[model samples]
Target: MDAKEKPETTSSMPQRRPDCIKCFDALWFCYSPFHQMQNYYRYGEFDNCFGKWGDLVDCLALKTKRAAEAEEILIAREKAKPHIWTFRTVDEASENWWRMYKHLVLMSPPLPGAAQPPPRSDKS
Candidate 1:
């Protein structure tokens, strides 16, 4: 707290890159017919966020300007992108579903410390 001394500070947050695609998507949402229709119904006129279009344009330009670094990140993301795993056959999917159903419906026990669930009241 001395006049000539600097305050001690510490920060350990990870840096995150701003995503250009989010800006592009926001711009598209602003221009969608469904949104315009909703605006018309609510206010008796259509409205659009043209400023979001400028955000998208600026993002694209920045990406182009930093192509060298951006390209490296893009390459890493392309290589790391995950495809969902799937059951190859209908029978395989059905078998897995039945196994899960049986486990939950018949085999699993209540947690040791938990009270039994109340019986569900019929609504008719």
Candidate 2:
């Protein structure tokens, strides 16, 4: 019989793995700089080209700092867990926290105009 026609013989595949929070965090952390750069390059509204470049550099530095901090937290968590019973939960929480942190980092900050009040008049 054709393989297609025969009953499935192989064991059913396992459930698709949930996104590993740690992996997701790392992915977001890595993606932020590129995303910010793309947005800035595409929009091109800044007063000077150099300012945009500076923003890009700043964004990259921010992402790098975040990644380093996350790594430190992960290392600390691993070191603190001597017993196995709590290991799985602690690891999962750490991964989720890191992932959420990454997500926050990837999110674009409020537009400058949105955050800043209009320039005040000297007469006041």
Candidate 3:
């Protein structure tokens, strides 16, 4: 077979992912019709290849390891602009944000210079 007559093959191509900066999470992307159609050519039913909790965890681990190797703590936060979408109502959107704020407050570690909680008293 002549080289010029051979059909084009993608064997030498690298894997690709959609640059979804607006994506929230894996489930959201996986269920999104837009993403489904976008990735239809590469991966039809495997949306997790781009976005997943495990992928985030792995990224954190790698970053942490690299920071430790460099003798630096990975303590940083980026203020992100929230994505706006139509909710049931303005009240519903406010409530959703309030709930997320509460969750963060409960789960986050004490901030620097914040009062430490009282030590737990154990009864023998």
Q: How much lDDT does each candidate structure score?
A: 0.68, 0.52, 0.52
lDDT of 2 by residue, 1-124 (tens): 8767977645574322223454445445445766557656888632334544554554454455555464565566668978766545764675556556755544767665543322344743
What is the TM-score of each predicted model, taking all chains together? 0.36, 0.19, 0.23
Error of model 3, residue 31, in angstroms? 4.4
Which residue pairs show collisions in model 3?
none
Q: Pairs clashing in candidate 1?
A: none
Model 3 stretches astray by more than 4 angstroms: 1-31, 41-54, 66-124
Candidate 3, lDDT over the whole model: 0.52
Ranking by TM-score: 1, 3, 2
lDDT of 3 by residue, 13-79 (tens): 5333323333336646666777777778676553555446555554555444543342322222112
Best by TM-score: 1
lDDT tens string, model 1, 1-124? 7888986545453333558989978878878999889989999987768789788876676566555576566567757977677435875665556656755644567677854433444743
Clashes of 2: 0
